[model samples]
Target: MNGFTGELIGTAILIVFGVGCGANSNLKGAYGKGSSWLYLCLCWGFAVAFGVYAAGQFGADGHLNPAITLGFAAFGFFPWSKVGAYLLGQFIGAFIGALIVIIQYWPHFQIAKGKDDGNVINIFATAPAIRNPLFNFLGELIATFTFTFVLLNLGDFTQGLKPLVVGFLITVVGQGLGGTTGFALNPARDLSPRLAYALLPIPNKTSADWAYAWVPIFGPIVGGILAGGLQYLLH
Candidate 1:
């Protein structure tokens, strides 16, 4: 398969596990409702690893996250010519993955509506725990910076173990820095899912919160660039 196709399928699978877990945990009457943070952290970690493995199998680098693709391109680790394709694939995959989540949890959505809670959107996207845009942006920036930085540098370690290390890195970042903005280190992960939430007809869900959308998108871009530049200097 081509890089674009690999990225698309890999990211879709990643989002299925990542967003599906969130839906299972947050939506009322779901089997995994009330699951703890550790569960989410572990699932997302495995999600990234699985995505990488799947993408690699199809001859792609398996950068299911746009930020990683951008970071590599900026650092000359990836060809600039392919960045657009990778990004497009990632976003498209995320949208499809989120749609599956909505379908899988359709009944729970109705139960959630009865509660009338405004956080139903949390199943699809990230929101600041503190609701401060400026600080929230910074939180995403720092979290993504840490993620991209570690990802870029992991090549120095054991080649066969990089995927597992990346998974643990995601878990650490989510548990350590995710409290602020839910650690949306990938723009495609946040924006595409948010778009799905906005476009889909889910009752009692909160607005898409477009006001905070830029934080995740732009912050990750800036963070990726910073990571690439830093890696360049260190190398």
Candidate 2:
């Protein structure tokens, strides 16, 4: 019911259901290789929508992503004191949800393609399948930028369309730009899961791919901040 509790619960559910479905499907090769993208985006977006629908009316602010909260804070939509709390809650939720993914999929870790230690962390976080950090970073930046831009355009919470716009923006970006690096648009979405993968017991793991970790964290946050700045200037 409180802000922190609402954010934590919402984010945990989002990561668990959204990332879980897609990542799990990827490991299984169920919808064909990487077929989980669309469903993943939809799940995340719909999750956001539902979370807001339930939590927003209660003055929850419902930022499932730290970047989202930070973006609004930069735009002055969120207060300074509360932004940190929201971020803390988001990460906590992400960490918890990531643990669930690791525990649930421990069995498939050994059998999943690219599951070796070489890309172990990649499962929890993200990486460029093609090894080109330039394009990978660019893809993530653009997607987050697009999401932020739309958020700004939606304006104040006069109608509740803001949340829907945010969801739609993410869904579109995932469709258009997700191919390169799976679009790690939210920091918690990647880092939390990556941490779980690094800690979870798995056989024949390669390296956890820690080298490519920061991109997801910094890229989306920067994108959100820049979008907030740009929106401020335009107004």
Candidate 3:
């Protein structure tokens, strides 16, 4: 497959598992409901691994996240000409993946809505455990900085180990820094899914939380740019 198609499918796969796990844990009546945080972390890590594997052969280097694509492009690893296509594919794929999760856990969504414990948007997107925007933005920025930094350097050490390295990187970040903002290291991964949660007709859904949306999107872009600039300077 080409770069666009590869990124599309790869990101779809990532969200299918990533958001799927959240739904499994949060939505009532799901078999895996109440699963531990570690379980979610592992599932997301595996999702990244499998996403990279899915798009490994493509030209875009399996950049299922917009930050990765932009960072690589800014660092001259990826072509700027393809950035739009990659972003399009990633966002679209994430939306579709989230839609699938909604359908898969339709019954659970209704049940959770009835309970009204809180917003079910967490099942589809990231949120702050605490309500501090400064800390939340910093969390995403630092986490994504680490993410893009390690990703940029991985090419020097191994030829084909990026998938596994990135997967583990995600797990480590999730474990160490995800408590604040759920570690939305990718704009597409967060925003598109959030958009889906807003647009989709899930029963008794919560607000889309647009006020905090820019944190994940702009924070990661800022982090990606910084990481890319760092890599460029180092080279």
Least accurate stretch of 10 residues (summed lDDT) in model 1? 113-122
Task: Return the TM-score for candidate 3, rounded to 2 decimals.
Answer: 0.94
The RMSD of every model to the true structure, in order and in angstroms, is 2.0, 3.2, 1.9
Predicted candidate 2 versus true structure: per-residue lDDT over 1-235, tens digit per residue: 3777767877777677665665555564333335456776686677666655544654567667777788878888678888776787778888887777666666666566465323245456677767787777777788888887776676553246766766666677778887688788889878887776677665445566778888788888888888888888888
lDDT tens readout by residue for model 3, 1-235: 3778878988999999999999888776778878898898889998998888887656547889998888889878888988888898899989988999888888777777543543377887888999899988988999898888988877732237768777888898899988789998999999989999888788878888899999999888888888999988998
Show where candidate 3 strays beyond 4 Å.
114-119, 156-161
> Top lDDT: which candidate number?
3
Off by over 4 Å in 1: 114-119, 156-159
lDDT of 1 by residue, 1-235 (tens): 3788878888888889999999888877777888998899888998888877777776678888888889889879889998888898899999999999888887777667633432366777888898888888888888888888887866732236677788898899999999888888999999999999999987667678888889889888888888888999999
- Each prediction's TM-score versus the true structure: 0.93, 0.83, 0.94
Separately for all candidates shown, the number of backbone clashes (residues 3 or more apart, or on different chains) is: 0, 7, 0
In candidate 2, which residue pairs clash? 117-205, 117-206, 117-207, 118-206, 118-207, 124-193, 124-194
Candidates' C-alpha lDDT: 0.83, 0.70, 0.84
